[model samples]
Target: MKKLLFLLLFFPSLIYAQNKTGGINWISWDEVEAKMEKEPRKVMVDVYTDWCGPCKMMNNTTFSDPQVVQYINENYYAIKFNAEGSGEVTFRGTTYKNETYDANKAGRNGTHDLTRAIAPVNGRIAYPTIVYMDEDFGILSPVQGFYKPEQIMPILTFFAENVYKDKTWEEYTKAP
Candidate 1:
């Protein structure tokens, strides 16, 4: 009885310890707009769908990296948006929602209008896209795919420091 009690008490702590790692501070789009108005900061939106494998991978790996989490928390208003969710969001005086969403469809519901507006790559949407916006809510870029921590570090620094104005990505990457 004592052994079983010990195991029950200790196992939950072990699980909690293993899972208690730092991660990005994700906010909603409405909160981002409200916060930006008072104290402006660059916005980084993780445009993801529930069924995207790459998006889950990035959330587990890249976004979970301590350095990436700290840098993003410090420099940007991080938003984790479900691209197919039926939540209404207002940004820059325009309201966006998933008008044609089919909740019964499970993983294949209609995309949210905000995701379509922000992540359009030649009129197509891609999962695991990271959309960057300036302090004024102007889009900087929508980068797609699952990027490792090292691969995403430069992009984060470039935008955080506003280096895109004068330096091309090639020039920025080549710098020591």
Candidate 2:
């Protein structure tokens, strides 16, 4: 009887302890769209490819930061998108696919049409693009490259707070 009583009290605490972590709650694109339809919120899409080293680094460090995780969870619907993976993903009324994907291919593979349409920087694509979108799912910007936790915080805030509407990136970053 004592063991059963102890088990009942301790099991819930153990589950709660395991649940706490500095991790972003990543969701699928379809889930994001459905949730936003009922209640709108900003979106952050982590566009990554399997062979990208920097992308893995950000996942280990920047995205793992407690502050970043908390802020994103509170303010945005996050999506971890595989830029080279196979699939048909429709955004803004258009469907996209990776035409050159080969199952046998090892390291690097074809870029998805979704990546070209959303994550390009000056007509070129790069991995680890942190794409921010508005509450309506309009593309605010695609911030490409790896960033440290502190470095990414301001960028996250700028989009979350809608500061981009009033100030340029330079102006927003310059302010105290």
Candidate 3:
């Protein structure tokens, strides 16, 4: 009975402890451009809003997974960007702002100009948007939805392995 009680109490913490999970290296957006300039690794930006439930879930579940974290941290310069933030960013000689940021409205969020400039089709501009880019910061894909760790594993690995160089997702997935 005592062992069972202890296990139940600590299990949650064990799941969340940030230790050697998959290659996820959480970082701020400001660091991404500089890091890319310095080393030029692939980049994966997690564009999220504070009130989005799925965004929170990814942080506590998918991102917390050891395999996901390890792979992301190893191959991509992972960044977390708050879509509705007033954080200053310089992009192509222009500045962007939320200007009218509202803290409410069914959890809908705003974004800076930089977000608009970098987002892919659908303009991302959505909660929990995952933007994948190549080493040169060229946009690859924008996944604007919730996904489990397993669901994202292949997508992440596909980009990391340079599979995009020769085959499409459909072709690669079908090729053994």
Per-residue lDDT for 32-150 in model 2, tens only? 99999988999999999999999999998888777888999999999999999998898878889999998899989999989988899899899899999999889999999999999
For each candidate in turn, the TM-score is: 0.87, 0.87, 0.80
Model 1, span 52-165: residue lDDT tens: 999999998899887898999999999999999999989889999999998788776898999989998778889999999999989999998899999999999999999999
TM-score of 2: 0.87
> At residue 26, what lDDT does model 2 achieve?
96
Top candidate on lDDT is 2
Q: For each candidate in turn, give its C-alpha RMSD to the true structure in angstroms.
A: 3.4, 4.8, 3.1
Arrange candidates by lDDT, highest first: which order?
2, 1, 3
Candidate 2 vs candidate 3: the TM-score winner is 2
TM-score for candidate 1: 0.87
Ten-residue region with minimum lDDT total, candidate 1: 14-23
- Least accurate stretch of 10 residues (summed lDDT) in model 2? 14-23
